[model samples]
Target: MKLARLGSPGQERPVVVLEDAVLDLSSLTPDIDGSFLAGGGIDAVRDAVASGSLPVLEGADSLRVGAPVARPSAVVCIGMNYAAHAAESGSLPPERPVIFFKPPNTVVGPDDAVTLPRGSTKTDWEVELGIVVGRRTSYLDGPEQAMEHVAGFVVADDLSERTFQLEISGGQWSKGKAAAGFTPTGPWLVTPDEVDHRALGLRSWVNGEPRQDSSSRDMVFDVETILWDLSQYMVLEPGDLVLTGTPEGVALSGRFRYLTDGDVVELEVDGLGRQRHAVHAYEAAAR
Candidate 1:
């Protein structure tokens, strides 16, 4: 099932998507957050849908769509998990999964404006598949066990500022990745049963020109394995977001110019959804 949140930032209401129409789920749950998911929100929503208990959301089309889920506790990321993406960024595929974290506040709605950090010139884009966890998981035995913990998937744009990430930060990538609005996620959070996360077609474009064209099939460490690996070191909590790296064709590869003010980025993942973000200059007090 497709689930989403719609309204202004910080005031979104939960809704379920049925083809072209939207049904309000606010009567059943206040918001789709860690607590809600942990308490069997997906199952409850499914029952509500089957019992014809949810009401059609009025004027949902006019409201802004927020990230499918509320801010997660952590936004974990895998670095260069896609072999071709590693090659383009001038590196070899790693022997182990490279992990990093983007503070939860970095997440923003899919269509929001992305601010270019002051004095930055190498801002770039990455199209990634985001995994949302549904249960508390720790020290999972294997990939099969990891799959049982997944709640759904969403389209994630892992925007980066190259200078802060590679040259100026003394080697920690999160410095460049943790900027507000750097991670734009969702139009919907699609359940695992609705998507074949293993082989979806994922792509990205800037200013209407294609930049990245690849598939999830190219991932060096697929979803389940990455989750299994991460679970060994840290507990995967419900509503935790994991960005499973990007594929080849990004500006960091020296193929295209970095993003500038007014640039638009569009990303899409098969069976999940699409996102569009406009680049803008950073304002000191803007939230």
Candidate 2:
């Protein structure tokens, strides 16, 4: 099953996409929340689908979409989880996953404009696979157990402000990663049963030109390892999002140029869905 949030930012309503049609799950008995997916919520929705009791959403063409999950408790990101990306960034792959956080406010729906932050000049893009946790998990037994914790998957653009990321500041990378609207997530949140995580191919395009193109199989630390490692550090709760890291071919890879105002970035992953965003320069008074 594929879950989504539809309508304008701040006014988004939960939805489920099956084939070409969208279902307004908001009208159902179960409330729309992150835990819905993490805590056997998918099973309920599946039963509803089979029973034909779910509302078939019409006029969905008129509603704008937001991030699938309304408000994640935290957004965790993994750095250099892709060897080729690490190599391009002039660093070797880490022996263990490097973790960071992006404020939940950074989350936004797909197609929303990504505002370049003030006093920033090196904004860049990263297309990553985002895992949505379905339950509270601590010290997961192993990879298989870790997989069970995942509720679904979504496409995320880990938009970055590079200068603030590595320059003058000496703090964590989260500073550059947590800007508002920095994370463009979800046209759809596909359940694990509906898609094969290992076989999916992800690709990103900047202003209609392709940039990152790779498969989840290329991940140095796959989804299971990431979830397992993450649970070891802190409790993984429902609605927590984990960005598994971007594949090779980012601008930071040194093979292409960075983003500028009015540039549109597009990204997609097999079975999950696609996301698009327009880039604009930040104005101080605008924030």
Candidate 3:
């Protein structure tokens, strides 16, 4: 099932996307947040749709689409999970997954404008598959047990500023990753049953020129392994998002020029969806 949110920035209403129309789920739930997902929301929506009991949302096409899911508790990210990306970044794939965090506030709607940081010269783009957790998980035995804890997936762009990430800020990647609107996620949150997460094509383009073209098959640490490994140390709660890293072909590899004002980035994951963002310079007064 495909779920989404529609309306202005902070006033979005939950919706279910059908063939050519969107059905309002506001009658059943307030918003698609952690509590909603944990409380059998998916099943309820499916039942409602199958029974033809949901109301078709009028004027939905006119409303601004927001991130499919509401703010999660944390947005966790894995670094260099792709073999080629690791090589491109001048490193070897680690035996264990490398983890980082992008504060929840960094998340924005897929089509939102991305603000380039003040005095930044190396803002880069990373197209990643984002995992959304559905249940509270801890100390999972292995990857075999990871699927049941996952709710769905979303397309995420892990935007970065190379200078803040590598050269300064003491080498903490999150320092460059946590800027507002840096993480643009979702046109929809697709359920696990609807997608074969193990194998999907993901690609990105800057201003209509392709930069990264790769598949999830190239991932060094697949989705199941990432969840299992993370569960051992931290509790994976409902609505927590995990960015599974990017494939090769990022600007940081010295292959393409960094993003500038007015540049547009388009990214897509085979079954999940596509996203577009226009880059703009950061404005101090807006903060």
Candidate 4:
């Protein structure tokens, strides 16, 4: 089943998207959030759909699509999970996950307009597979148990400013990654039963020209391992978002120019969904 939120930012209402209809989820719960996921929301939705308890929403295709889940308390990121991406960025493949973070506020709708950082010459894009945590997690006994804690998957874009990430402040990557709207997630949070996860096509484009073209099969640490490894060090609360890393062919590779004003980025993961972002130059004044 596919889940989404629709409407203006901060006012979006939860929904269940099927091939033929969009069902109102506001009747079941107020939002598609931590509490909902932790309290058998997906199961409830499935039962409601089977019982024909949901009302179909009209004109949903015309509304803005918000991230599939709301109020993500933590946005954890993995860097260099793709060996070729590590090579492009002048780094060797790490023996363990390279973790960082973007403040949760950075999460935005899949189609929202993003802004290139001011005075930035190295702003870039990453197309990643996103995992939404279903329950509180810490020190799992095995990697296989970690999948039980996964709520679903979403398509995610991890935007970065290379200078802030690599050339400044003692190499703190989050500095480049925390810009507003840097994380464009979802269009759909597809349940595990619907996805292979082990092998899926991942791709991206800049103004319709191809950039990254790879697969989740290329990830050094698969979903189960990533979550299990992460749990050993930090608690992944319900509704936390984990970005599993991007494949090769980013602007940072020097094969393509970094993003500038009016650039458009499009990304997708097989069966998850697609997202497009029209980027503008950053304004120094308050938004």
| TM-score, per-candidate, Cα-based | 0.98, 0.95, 0.98, 0.98
Superposed Cα deviation of residue 126, candidate 1 (Å): 0.4
lDDT, candidate 4, 1-287, per-residue tens = 99999999999999999999999998999999999999999999999999999999899999999999996999999999999999999999899999999999889999999888778888999999999999999999989998899999999999999999888938579989988889999999999999999998999999999999999999999999999999999999989999999999998999999998888999999999999999887773236
Q: Evaluate all candidate structures by whole-model CA lDDT and list the values in order.
A: 0.93, 0.85, 0.92, 0.94
lDDT value, candidate 2, whole model: 0.85
**Global lDDT of model 3:** 0.92
Report the error of model 1 at residue 53, Å: 0.7
For each of the candidates, the C-alpha root-mean-square deviation to the true structure, in angstroms, is 1.3, 1.6, 1.3, 1.2
TM-score of 2: 0.95
What ranges in model 2 sit over 4 Å off? 29-31, 284-287
Q: Could you tell me which 10 consecutive residues in candidate 1 have the lowest summed lDDT?
A: 278-287
Best by lDDT: 4
Model 4 lowest lDDT segment of ten: 278-287
Clashes of 3: 0
lDDT of 3 by residue, 4-56 (tens): 99988999999999988899999999999999989999999999999999999
What's the ranking of the predictions by lDDT, best on top? 4, 1, 3, 2
- lDDT for residue 228 in candidate 1, whole number 0-100: 95
